[model samples]
Target: MSPTTRASRRRRPAAVTIHDVAARAGVSVATVSRVLNRKTPVREETSRQVLEVARSLRYVPNVAARSLSIRRSHTIGIVLPEVHGDFFSEVIRGIDLAARRAGYHILVSGSHSDRNEMLEVLAAMRGRVDGLIVMSPDVALSALHDQLADQLPLVLLNSVAEGHTAITIDNYGGAHAMMRHLGTLGHSRIAFIKGPDRNADASERLRGYRHAMRQIGGRAADLEVPGEFSEESGYAAAGSILARHERPTAIFAANDAMAVGVLSAVAAQGLNVPADMAVVGFDDIPIARYLAPPLTTVKVDIAELGRRSFEAVIDRIDRGLPDQPRHECIPTSLVVRQSCGAATSLRRTKKASGKKKTTRQEEI
Candidate 1:
């Protein structure tokens, strides 16, 4: 062959096959297939070796051929209300991590929190995925039941449906804990920025707030301001609260994003955080701790929620759905920081103890 022909042949390498992977990894062809397709469980070490060998050889599985033979799609569909926020990103990250390890791909779609849009997305995913993980807190369970195919395994995140696996955060518990913290700080006239009216998580948090307020003989109805879980809405709600004849001593935003806006609004009014107006939020997003005063909020393991939901769906896909549907509620914890005046209280305690002032340690 000519020099040019030799170079071209070298550049265009032959495709690596399953047989090649099995031979290199010292495993049977069936073992290689099992590991690559994840259709059956293989020994952990052997599976790892086969995958590593395949990767070293730059082997690519023929997904269409496999699907045709097995009647399965090695992909998981993830439908969420919105995908732009940090919370959603974290959740996706977790799901992706699990999916990759299980030799599956993910198809993510945002439904814009609209019923029609969600149904359309579901329709598009019909035959494209083996299972689905949906987070539609605004939609009713009955509507979802009517839309989804009965055979497709599904896991829900932050939503509940009968006869389906679900993973949800303890929104009510988190909100109630925050309320207790605020009450302990003697914040009776606390203002709350509510999330979307129909959202399940939002409703649960609102219920918690009301329940906690009632326990303390405080009126929740007068101090609540509507928000759409956006920074702009939070800022607007803060403005409304600040404009009132009797301003609240503290503001509790539904989530960290809104709390950020509340912080901005408070600053624009020439007020100091924790001192002039204590600010708290829920869903401690990554940036919550880095905020000016370091926001105190309810901590939810957002990524773990995604990972768990993915696992639940994959389990159903692999082992078939159980007679009893699984429902998991992830616990939330309180994260105390400067934003809620916790640091000030700590400093006072230290001063009284005659200890030098130190950086505040976050309480969980």
Candidate 2:
């Protein structure tokens, strides 16, 4: 317990810092930092030497210190109204992968479909993140316009909320296309399942269906059911649709979850798809192909939505806002599987064959 022995025992290993890495590599702390953060390109030899020194010293850059100096967290945030599972996760993966490629990390939170919760999350995230990306936001568009829109870089996905930059599929076009596919299938008395009323994307899709149905059949009354983007809502809607004495010949669910529910409802009523009643869904979810008849649905490139949303925020963060608010309307197309995307190919093939058959008859 001598004082000298105690002092020696109390001594701690020197914690490695960026300064140490720079000194060992014979470079400036800035150069060492650029190399470690991968912020800027480094000469091959210098990069190798710096990396070697950092590893030798067990060096790790302090992100907070770096952010403090740079005024950037090298991070973004994604707030969601409903981030169910597969769909949101894939979108997030796309955003994360693209962001990392550009040298950034992400912060994520869910809004639980609560307006107050969304407001709280946005308030809490204020001034912390470099940018924010929201999916299916529940905030008032006017509030976003007046108060928070210009505060930071913001991008919105599948949202009714307004943004300086936003990305979403053409739900109206996609829905109209789907309805036209059903029209060609001899489905005059088609049924429609509607998604949440407040959701801008769902509302546009419903409008598309109504308009397209009018084009084909002149009216869409008694041919639509309500849905809520969930299996339970689909099931409930399906039950009511089936209870009708004059049921629809075909049913187009607003989304795949509703289509699956329709499938169950159809089975309960002892009806087979494309035989007794054709069923179609939207979103082209991964499980769509595995269904009994495979759900014919509209496909939105959800990954691209996520990737583009991230890009939108990054662009805004780098450059000031555009003269006018930028609103990007992404394109969506019908996927022609046995359920829906394939409907056109099959009909075309059959028509070509029929034409050939008629030609042979004429020759004979």
Q: Report the lDDT of model 1 for residue 273.
A: 96
Q: Give the distance in Å from residue 162's predicted Cα in candidate 1 to where it truly belongs.
A: 2.2
Give me the overall lDDT of model 2: 0.75
The most accurate candidate by lDDT is: 1
lDDT of 1 by residue, 12-113 (tens): 554566777878899887999998769777999999899999999898976777788888898999999888789898999999999999989999999988
> Which stretches of candidate 1 lie above 4 Å from their native place?
1-59, 344-364
Query: How accurate locally, in lDDT, is each candidate?
Result: 0.86, 0.75
User: Candidate 2, which segments miss by more than 4 Å at Cα?
Assistant: 1-15, 23-31, 34-49, 137-139, 143-147, 160-163, 339-364
lDDT of 2 by residue, 99-167 (tens): 999998888888876666777787888767898887653455564453356477777787645335678
Which residue pairs overlap in candidate 1's backbone? none
Model 2 poorest 10 in a row by lDDT: 355-364
